[model samples]
Target: MENKYEDYKNEIKEGKRTLNQTRKELGLPPINGGNTEFINREIAFCRKIQERR
Candidate 1:
């Protein structure tokens, strides 16, 4: 059962579902902001995720 759920979880994570969902939960704007400031903010967010480990 756990394995099956993990498979489903991994499938969604592969599509950036978790990241996008979290962003939505925080009420943040869409990831594709289409500007230099937004790109920098996205990079910062990626770095924050990397640092979590």
Candidate 2:
């Protein structure tokens, strides 16, 4: 199965726009950072979760 994010780069791009709009609405910090950390952290978290059960 094709990863949606890989197949649909536009979705993430559009989401960035929507997120910015929401951030501005609430005056939150800009979501500008590498997703690598999220990927690594989630992978580790999932491994831990799977190990538990």
Candidate 3:
């Protein structure tokens, strides 16, 4: 499937909005992907849970 962000170029240009602002205006999350700390913490937690099984 095509990536959806590619479809936003003209709307973003016409609105004079940054990608982050566009996402916010569309009621999407402020960040597209989780940050490094959240990702690392999730990985560590999953590893700990797996070790108990």
Candidate 4:
């Protein structure tokens, strides 16, 4: 089976979708504090994965 989380990550990495869009698709609530620490972490993780390739 395919991994939805990984697919969403790829979408973000490829600029096919925004972090908020992915979050909504994943049934997650929007961040209210304007603190995107989690989103930034995920983006950083994606960049690392791309660099490894």
lDDT per model vs. reference: 0.69, 0.62, 0.72, 0.83
lDDT of each residue in 4-24, candidate 4, tens digit only: 888888988999999878878
By TM-score, the best candidate is: 4
Which scores better on lDDT, 1 or 3? 3
What C-alpha lDDT, on a 0 to 100 scale, does residue 37 get in candidate 4?
88
Q: Alpha carbon lDDT of residue 11, candidate 4?
A: 85
**Candidates 2 and 4: which is better by lDDT?**
4
Candidate 1 lDDT over residue span 1-53, tens digit each? 47744665685778846655655665766566555698687789999999998
Cα lDDT of model 3 by residue, 6-34, tens digit: 65777677776677787776775555465
Task: Indicate the residue-level lDDT of 17 in model 3.
Answer: 66
- Model 4, residue 29: distance off in Å is 1.2
Ten-residue region with minimum lDDT total, candidate 4 = 26-35
- TM-scores for all candidates: the values are 0.36, 0.36, 0.37, 0.53
CA lDDT of 15 in candidate 4?
A: 97
The segments of candidate 1 whose C-alpha lies over 4 angstroms from its true place after superposition are 1-34
lDDT of 2 by residue, 1-53 (tens): 76644544554476754655555555544455665676577689999999999
Give me the candidate number with maximum lDDT. Answer: 4
Order of candidate numbers by TM-score, starting with the best: 4, 3, 2, 1
Error of 2 at 29 (Å): 15
> Candidate 4's error at 35, in angstroms?
5.6
Model 3 residue 5 distance off true place after TM-score fit, in angstroms:
22
